[model samples]
Target: MNDVQIRTFQVPGARLHYEVRGTGPLLLMIPGAPADAGALAGLAACLSDRYTVVTYDQRGLSRSVLTEPPADQDVAVFSDDAHRLLAALGDEPAYVLGNSGGALTALDLAARHPERVRALVVHEPPLPELLPDRERWRAVFQDVYDTYRDQGAGMAMGRFIATVEGDGAAPPAMPDPSQMPPEALEMMGRIQGNLDHFLAHVLLPVLRFEPDIAALRSGPVPVTVGVGAASGDGVPALSARVLAERLGVEPLVFPGDHQGLATDAATGAEIIHKTLA
Candidate 1:
């Protein structure tokens, strides 16, 4: 068993909260929007034996405190943050994994600073530029934002989750806010406070911006696009396929849907370990 040590890195505007566990090559895992380091705890525990697993709360979320509120969440800024964190770890090029928006950041990092990354596994990155229905999703994401502003957090989050699941099945009925467990309530609070920030700053900007395909293709680092087997050909899964096609590499299928790392950590870790090895 490895001890989890919490540390803080003072980047320009944010003091990022990161954890280091296990011992070996560093594997940095970035969580999706609205999820923090806690989201990666299970996966980190599973992989820590063979690799030094690291996870962090993105700026303005969880314990990663920011000096000022950012008006727009730029992928480049997020990538730079990842780059600085890797530099802080040492000269070794770290293995990186990003789920959803984190995947977008990973792609950005590989595109700009290929030397800092050894192998990047991007699982379910939502790149609008690659999809033919970019306009439709643009409207869908915007509706989520509108729900946040016009309706409220509960409604907005419901829509956001529904849109991402993209299972064609109708979303499950939202439980009464009052009957929820303590953790559920707490998460809702976090979502309520952060959803506006995420929609206004991160969501639209990241999906709309195109990653440097030419740079990724020519870079020295290895990039693996991962898709969840259980996630039907949703937008994110399709995005992964398109990215793999562009890179001329096959997509790695994991056990569960977008939240596989949290749901089925052991299997997800094994697949990732083999891929990196």
Candidate 2:
């Protein structure tokens, strides 16, 4: 395993906590809301031998502390935060991969600062606006946000999870907690603690973001949309397929479900390696 170097960068409204490992070209892995750098540590380790992998806690998530009170998050702000982090890291463009809500951030980053990104892989970006069933999803997400405000995070998260899990005909294939390593357990605990903040401030804004399709299409940066083979025809997979169509590219299939990179890092890493190769 490569020695992980933890660092911090001062952004406009918050201090960002980041981790760096491996040695080669830069590969920045962006995690979705409520998840910190540890969420992507397994994926990073798999890619470390070939590339310098960077993962960070977005503002108000985990060690990335806010200078002011938490409020509704913005995709542009998130992208700008990523922009500054890349600018500070080096002049060369970095390979960027953003998963779930983080994919929204990556889209905005590539649109706004294409010069900073060598290439981008958007893994199941939940852009309802891009989907054929936009209105339905919009109502669903609004209800989730409303539930957070009125009923609290527990109820809101239940609705959110149910929507993401699709049909719900079968129990979700989840890893047994008792067998997970200490670091994995700690990461799970941190994510649970972040739920309130995520549901209240992060979730809705991300789902509501309108990607700059025109800009992304004409930009210099190459973009690849990815979906998990096991994600089925859920909103995430469908949304990714729509985005790929708009971009004139086919959706890349990887291992596992929505959380593929974390659960099947080796296979996911190989797919990413070949895609960027």
Candidate 3:
């Protein structure tokens, strides 16, 4: 069933562009910064056979336009956006999977509205604040922000990438553009355009976010922290381990590294199926 419907919904300060596919219990997949809904399209399609998959461009990204001028983004608002999206889409709690910074949003969401989440799977959330040398990470993030301001998105991103380079083999290379679908190409272009806003406004604020540990640890929501099998010693994986320890659960191992969800959807879908089961 390849039927997919695109829709829009107006939130407080933004209008969200979201897509719905398949038929089953609701499954919301949240993408990280600079990635809109399309980043997870493959994974969503793979899981659609057993899920009513929902994916959306977050505020100020791609088709999700900000009603007001762009500014530093807030985790609280992002969580609220997810809450509103879920409330609008269905009456029942939904299963959620968030990747990278998206995982941070999911963590905040579960902590803020535990009743709205049936279960949550956070894949390598980059919670620098949770690390042992948080101050150093904080300084690095600050430098990234400053670099974005003084230089540009490219330089800032280079610094950011250096900090999170995993011990694993590199992620899969992008397919040839000529061989790519038009929609996929469009999504890539849109994501590229979002780099400026993401680096200047979203990066530092998100990195500075501290999840409410007490709420997540004691809340009703079942939180599953996961790490890529190959993302050894990376900041994201380290943070995932720390978060899992705090939540009192071992981190679930998933295939590939941080970008696995986007690059290896079939395997990711299968693993997620087994996990949710």
Give the best candidate by TM-score.
2
| Model 1 TM-score (2 dp) | 0.91
Candidate whose lDDT is highest = 2
How displaced is residue 89 in candidate 1, in Å?
Answer: 1.1
Put down candidate 1 lDDT per residue, 89-131, tens digits, no spaces: 9998899999988898889988898888999999999886788
- Model 2: colliding residue pairs: none
lDDT of 3 by residue, 22-102 (tens): 999999989988889998999999999899999999999999999998888978889899999999997899999999989
User: Using Cα atoms with residue i matched to residue i, what is each candidate's TM-score against the true structure?
Assistant: 0.91, 0.96, 0.95
Candidate 2 per-residue lDDT over residues 58-83, each given as its tens digit = 99998899998888898998999999
Whole-model alpha-carbon lDDT for candidate 1: 0.84
The Cα local distance difference test for each model comes to: 0.84, 0.89, 0.88
Model 3: lowest-lDDT 10 consecutive positions:
165-174
Which of 1 and 3 is ahead in lDDT? 3
RMSD of each: 2.7, 1.3, 1.7
Tell how far residue 169 is off in model 2, in angstroms. Answer: 4.7
